[model samples]
Target chain A: MSSRNRIESVAHQTVQKSGLKNLSFRTLGAEVGVKSSSVHYHFPEKSDLGGALIQRYRQSLATTLAEIDDASPNAYDAIKLFSKLFTQECSEGKICFAGMLAAEVEFLNESNREGLQAIFNMYHTWLLDQLNQAGDELKIDLPTPTVAHLLLASLEGALLIDRAHPTNDRLSSVNILIDSWFGKIN
Target chain B: MSSRNRIESVAHQTVQKSGLKNLSFRTLGAEVGVKSSSVHYHFPEKSDLGGALIQRYRQSLATTLAEIDDASPNAYDAIKLFSKLFTQECSEGKICFAGMLAAEVEFLNESNREGLQAIFNMYHTWLLDQLNQAGDELKIDLPTPTVAHLLLASLEGALLIDRAHPTNDRLSSVNILIDSWFGKIN
Candidate 1:
């Protein structure tokens, strides 16, 4: 792989395993079989590298959501599909990187914060679109904006709980709540 | 201050600003004007210090919740009180340490994970008691376990969203949703 690719891959793993704090030149250098100086040659600062990682994560998530554009979907199915995707990601031990970074927004640089917002924006836009489509098809009253934030926030939070507790039982318990909240409307 | 208190103060700041990955004896000692060896004199291993910090955070949160008991004789008041306390902390740019550690549970030592769970257990216990009391007064039916988990998860997740987007407006938006859901329930 090119040095840039190698650096991004390494930083991604480090963030995945240890979060943003451990994304340093020394760590990336070790991971990529390069010296810290060489790592710096490709990316002048850690923030720049972080910006790239954030962008890559956003793109990857966007791509994942893009793949599931089913035709003729109703509001309930749309919500269920989103929940299924979220729960599957949690089960795989990964979650929305933007969601994770959001927990530490006070500490993030301006650029990183904007990048994180872009991820949420993408999610909200897609979600609103689905909700509109579903609401029209199902002829149901729904709280679009509130439901949008609720779905994202609750899924992110549930992932934290499930990971901390690490029980399928707990996850299923949460799914019941999600299903009830969305199911009644759909 | 005692060496234990000194180490804790430093770890608290580190956890607040940079999070657990940046938590180390050397970094924490530097924050407190001590050598890493001197810090180790107080904490034989990193886990010893981390475990203590987690305990301190739990105690502090419990103390905060204890104060709410005075204002929360009924369920409606209790829920409102809890929401106020939670939002105030988030708006002040504080991420709950247990919540943060829970995200990193997959990477944490067994001791750290235990500490995280203990925090959650304390939180859930307090919430259950408050909800049960409120339910009786308000005549609202709530599934104690499910309600406990839902409230905790939604609040934590909303903090992540508000922190991520971080407009003053986002806080109000989340508060509205909280009121709409939890407020109406009981």
Candidate 2:
């Protein structure tokens, strides 16, 4: 990896493990085998680094969602595939990076905050589209926006709870929720 | 409030506003009108303060839940009251204290981590009892534990997302979930 990618990689891992608050240039320096100044050379300000991190993360998530779209045959399978991303993160003993950033939104700089918002907007829009497409063929009881909000919130919340207690039941809960929603669909 | 109480109060607000990561002795001291050393005097270590904050928060939550039980007539009402507590916090532009702490759990010391765990346990147990009682009299499609987990996770996750975007629809989404669960109950 290049220096910038190396920095982003370590920063992502740190944020996932401990949260945005625990992330610092000094720690990144120690982990990346560079001095703090060298870390600064790549990104002068923490917010700049934060902005870059979220921008990269958003691109990666968009790519993953597009792949799921291409691979899944139906809306239900698409939703399941999306949820597995969060489940996979929890199974590795980390909260979703976006969820972690969401918790620290107030602490983030303007650029970083906007980046986080864009990521959520992307998720909400994508989920909304899936629900709408499914609702056309199936009977969806709640409004698409509400269901989209619920899915995002529930999955993110489950990851937080499961990480704290570690019952390994988040994926099951996600599955049950999806099944329940489908039962409502028609 | 006593100095200790005052310190805990400020720390709680800081954690809710920014996150546990941005909270510090200096900030607490500045907010509380004391020196950093004075803040240290109240709690020798940062973890000590974290433990005390969660302990105080847990006590407040316990009292609130008891009052909700005393005031609410049925499962649905009790659930609404519980959700209102979270809504009230969001209205004040804050995340639930426990939810904020959960995001930074990996950075916390053992005592603080256990304290956070205990808070979640209290919530789960309380919600589980309410769900089981309601399930006995009505038709609850999902298992009591699963429903309890869903309620807790959704509420917490919604708070985090709502804070990031400020759509003012978290309460609505929460209501829809509760109503859907109740719809299942019949």
Clashing pairs in 1: B75-B134
Worst 10 residues of 1 chain B by lDDT: B134-143
Q: For residues B43-118, could you state the per-residue lDDT of candidate 1 as single tens digits?
A: 7887777788888888888898888877665666676778777766543566656677775665678988888888
Second chain TM-score, each model: 0.82, 0.92
lDDT of 2: 0.81
What are the per-model DockQ values? 0.44, 0.59
Over A10-68, each residue of candidate 2 has an lDDT whose tens digit, in order, gives: 89878887776668799898889899999899889888888888989999989999998
Measured with DockQ on alpha carbons, how good is candidate 1?
0.44
B76: Cα error in model 1, Å: 2.1
User: What ranges in model 1 sit over 4 Å off?
Assistant: A1-14, A24-44, A103-108, A136-143, A168-174, A184-186, B1-3, B24-27, B30-37, B136-142, B168-174, B182-186
Docking class of 2: medium
Per-residue CA lDDT of model 1 for A1-186, tens digit only, reads 788898898677666555675456886798789999998887788778878988888888787777666632466666667778767644456555666677566557899889988888888788777776664443323366666675666667777776787664344545665556554422
Residue A167 shift from truth in candidate 2, angstroms = 1.6
Best by DockQ: 2
Candidate 2 lDDT for residue A14? 84
